[model samples]
Target: MLEIEQFLHWQRAIGRSQNTVRSYARHLSQFYRWLAARGIVWDELDFRQLCDFVAVLTAGLPPLPSRCGGRAPGTVKAVSAAVREFYEFHRVEGRGPQDLVLTRNPSKLPRRAHSFLAHLEHRRPREVSRLARPDRQSAETVQVIDFETDFAKLLAAASTTRDRLLLSAQYDLGLRVGQALGLRHGDLNPMRRQVMIRRRDDNANGALSKQKTQFIVEAPRRFFDLYAAYLLGEIAHVDSDYVFVNLSRPPVGGPMTYSNAYQLIERIGAAAGIDDLNPHMLRHTHATALAKAGWTAAEIAARLGQSHSASADVYIHLASDDLAEKLRTTEHLVWREPQQYRLKGDGDGAR
Candidate 1:
């Protein structure tokens, strides 16, 4: 527990954005509980045992002495990665003269080892993880709402301009909940109609950017309209520098926290008669909307402020009729517009 606490503090000191530090703290806490329940020493785990931990997570089993189900593969992988970092950090710090044996480097392994390649159908290097569930977030796809219907309902149901702006940030700008809440007034560029997502560790609400570096995202014209209205109307009296803050609620000038966003969105969802609506679902809707509008996978990733196209791939779902027509025309289904291909392999210039 002391080591975990130290690791979290060091993460913040080293300029890890607030969201990442929170994730490391949150997941490490869960891992600590699991280790306690199983009576397993975390620092003493061998590489194979660490992989087994990931395998157990992949299978959706609860930790010992608990009934809660497992997290998704991406989340589990994140936790695993954090644990590896924790061990490595302490090892390098010479705590217990510890050493990380996971050895993520592939160069250390023998090249073309026949015995190791025997059952390797996918050619995945080592047993570092079998938890690479590609569609791990596929459940989010079902939660997405169409742009014309449910998204409108949500916006219409919002009781205040502040809440409406929050929804717009997620839907129109494709911001994660943390990213939206972390926004400061300085990040908005009305002249350019862009919002800068700068990586930072400071926020009164403990909000943080998930992005490692700064990037700007284009915002809808209507979003800025609402932003102006919110500033003059609902949020005018708030004393916070954050773009979004508590307006009518208590502690009225405070930056919006994750819990505040969650509860507010849930209330808005109920008012709209939309069940289980969440902030992330709005982001999901944004990505899917772009896909429907012929945005390529890379374009979607850029719009979402994600670095990997694979992260954007899950949202490229097509209807049966569309798939059938595309398959009929060509042997493969193409999601990008033809011109988007010429933009690929060039930098993130498309962004």
Candidate 2:
């Protein structure tokens, strides 16, 4: 347990973001708890034990009713990576045996291998079959909503200007909830029609971008209008720099936490008759709109502030019907025959 704290501190020292460190801590804690339950000692941990743990995470072995079913493969991978890192740290400190092995391939040896035999050895970490696991997340489970109509319902259901703007940021700017809530007053630029997502260490509510990099995203004009209203009405007397603040009784001026943001969405969703609505769904809605509107993958990725197009691929897949429609239009324009050139047997086609 003490080593977990040390590992977290080391992660911070290496400049990992707070959210990442917290995730690592959580993963390691779960692994350690599982080990303890089985009366397994740390020093006795081996590759087989690690494999068993992975099975538990990927298959929900030794089923516990209170526990949710197996986690997604991506989550299982994260847990495995954390455990591997923990082992590496312990091995480096001479507190645990090496879990990885080194092997040499004589057939693929470099020309200089004879002079440097040690360099020929390649490090091979313990095996975990990533291919055998299920997808990190099931695309079919993603709930997409009718953006314009549902958004209007959300706006109508919002109790305050702040809540409305929160939804606007998520839906309009395609921001993750953390990115939206992390917004400070200065992050918004009405004149430039952009909102900056900057990395901050003091966000107690864990409002940080997944990429942990500062970037600006285009803001809807209406969102800026709401921002102006929120500043003057809801935030006028508040002293906090955070754009969103708690409106309910105690700690009214405090920064809005993630729970507060989620509850607001859930309440509005119920009123709007949209089941299981979430901030990420709004983001997906934005991405889907972009893909259907003929935006390039790179353009959509840039707008979403993603480092790569892979995350944007899901939206592209969701817009398959739109893509098919475009393809049909293209086919008609390039390959459709003139009406005057119909076959004699095709009576309906010969007009």
Instruction: Give a tens-digit lDDT track for model 1, residues 131-232.
Output: 344323335344677676887898899988888899999989989998999899999999999999976666788887777778999998989999999888
Query: For model 2, where is the 10-residue window of minimal lDDT?
Result: 130-139
Once fitted onto the true fold, the runs of candidate 1 whose alpha carbons sit more than 4 angstroms away are 44-70, 96-100, 103-143, 186-201, 210-216, 248-250, 266-278, 305-322, 325-351
Clashing pairs in 2: none
| TM-score, candidate number 2 | 0.72
Worst lDDT run of 10 residues, candidate 1, spans 129-138
Report the C-alpha lDDT of model 2 over 1-351, residue by residue, as the tens digit. Answer: 777887788888887765578778878878887887778887677666767777777776653112456665556667777887777677787776665422234334423323456667774543433323332343243567887988999899888899899999988999988888888888888999989998787786767777667888988798999999998998888998888888775688878877678778988998889876788889989888888787989889888888897768865545567767898879978787867776567866644
lDDT scores of the candidates, listed in order: 0.77, 0.77
